[model samples]
Target: MRFALLGVAVLAVSLFVMSGQMGVPSDLPFPVQVAIAGAAGVAAWHARRSWWPLAALGAVTYAWLVVWPPLLVASYFAGRTLGRGRGLAAYLGACLAVQGVSALVGEARDGPQEIMTASLGNALFMALGTIGLPLAVGLWTRARKETAEERARRLEREQIMRAEQVRAQERARIAREMHDIVAHRVSLIVLHAGALEVRTTDEETAETAALIGGIGREALSNLRDVLGVLRTPRPDSPAPDLSPHPALDDPDLSPRPALGDPDATYRPQPTLGDLDRLLDQSRALGITVTRHDEGDPRPVEETVERTAYRVIQEALTNVHKHAGDAHTDVLLRFADGELEVEIRNQRPHGHPENLLGTDLSGAGWGLVGLRERVELLGGTLRTSTEESGGFLVSARIPA
Candidate 1:
């Protein structure tokens, strides 16, 4: 309602300013302009739905009085904001009603000119008030609305893009954990299964191998889901050669001879006592993994031993790919209540470091997870490129 009064005051002041432009007389008296303005405000204040109608009437009246008429357009624009569609119609209707009043007023006057001439001029002025002003105002409203919606949609799209980026990061992290945990377990299973296959010929022994194979198949399935559907691509594609998810496939355990019953997975843990024998075991696979020990002997926890063994196993697995023919050295040290292990390798001259057929850059969190495992046990882990074109990982865990 207050807006209606402001609209009226704006219209009158504009008319006062442009009075010379329209050549309208100011003899209507200050009190008269105030009364007309008040009446228009009263009509519009409570009836905002139809305020444009009354303002449109005010514009027509101003035109008949020969005052600056452009100011009438303000009320039309203001009414559009205060009210919506119906206000425009109401404003137009009110303008016509005011024209009727003007005709009656002309009939009562004693001007020398014919009333019909003045009446026609008043009607033309009414058309400009109701039609010209409202048409332009409605168009302005439409354009404003369109721009606002575009901004809203743009903001929404940006939000969706940010959310998708976050989701991708989370998926990568999940995929990393799955690959690390599953790979470590599967490697051991394969190692032990190979052992069992060699030393056993009994039907029961065959049955166990079948079970291990079953487990491997299940692991492969899990890895498939956690990783991407397409791990590697066709030769024709330019995409990267990487696993989309973790490997759940069975571990490679084909080397076990059918001679010894060394069921070591769920029994007394495997440790350095088994290291000497294990090196000989890996050598049979045509992979050279030399071990070196230094520093004084120290007592360590069983968990640390198992974790250490698994770390080396993975390192060797990576070597089988990257340095199948590389001279590899495994160093273990115990000193000052700490246990440290360092694995370093130098590929044989002119041999490809990527002999395993797996992409090494894809080995990101494989080492990171191993490092985290070590750190969780109050340990420190470090990996860096060796000067001799080799790679080294050194880990130290408190005893």
Candidate 2:
């Protein structure tokens, strides 16, 4: 819209100037003068696209009638579009040639004395004021615009680099804290569990101790992988080695996957297929848990399945903490284009205060982490207490 207005303004000014020049009594008819003025206006309006044609027309008309608007407009646009190279040199050469031709035409009409005195002086002054000034302003404007754009791009790249540096520093700090606190505590738990497994005589007690120790060892392995990642220089590097390190090694612990194996670095994530084992683990801990399926089962993306599994795991963990031995139901409904997971638990049998023992209490970030995970996959998680005093946790994820 602005460009259209600019074009119209240029055309209007060109017509006004041309009309003033042609207003003097001449041999041309009034209609012919109007037609010539309209043509000059149109040429000035389109000077941006091809300024040379307008320049040529303006030179011819100026030599004959001493009109200058179209020539000034063409010179401004030529400076804007043409760089300081051969193109600009060629245009200046043409302008000089037009001045020479105009001088010769003036000498033919008036005498050589008039051409040498008043005519030459007026022509030089007009060329400097109309052409040189506008051309210089156009070139300066273009240079200023190019410099501002380049500075803006440089600032954007610098901002990105600073952001990455802050993120790397934060990751390194977190890795150090986790290694100092959580890793040390987990290592001690694994050692204690290993001692219990070796010293126990009863078969069932030994088996339970063995299971506890195995779970602790696996937790330490996963923690080590996470720390390795946080310590790496680049985020896109290959996964860290999963083989047991000397600091975390135990003779009684079961063997882990071999080092240097192609699949060792990329461990399989838990999915819906592992839901049965998860339920069994809760049942073994004396929790009454049951699972039900609705609608037809369909395969979904691995990320969706992983998030669903985590939702159920975190919900069950909450049940153990807040509803001791409460009846829990796990529902999986596979519907068109989506999968829904719901875990509902009955109210605790005893006082809630008694059920929430210090050992079973958590840091309370499980649900928050689960919500982040679900939302990242374009899903929603909801948790609420029912009127009957039961608690419900549900997640809906796109397949």
For each candidate in the order shown, give its overall lDDT on alpha carbons: 0.59, 0.74
Q: Please list the residue runs of candidate 1 whose C-alpha ends up more than 4 Å from where it truly belongs after superposition.
A: 1-32, 38-75, 78-94, 110-118, 129-131, 162-399
Model 2: lDDT to the true structure:
0.74
- Residues 9-66, candidate 2, lDDT per residue (tens digit)? 6556655554554221234566775666566766765664676777777777666655
For residues 254-318, write the lDDT of model 1, one tens digit per residue: 22213343331113445666676656645655567889889877667888886777677667667
Relative to the true structure, candidate 1 reaches a TM of: 0.38
Best by lDDT: 2
Clashing pairs in 2: none
C-alpha TM-score for every candidate: 0.38, 0.77
| Model 2: residue 236 alpha-carbon error in angstroms | 3.6
Error of 2 at 185 (Å): 1.9
Where does candidate 1 have its weakest 10-residue lDDT segment? 249-258
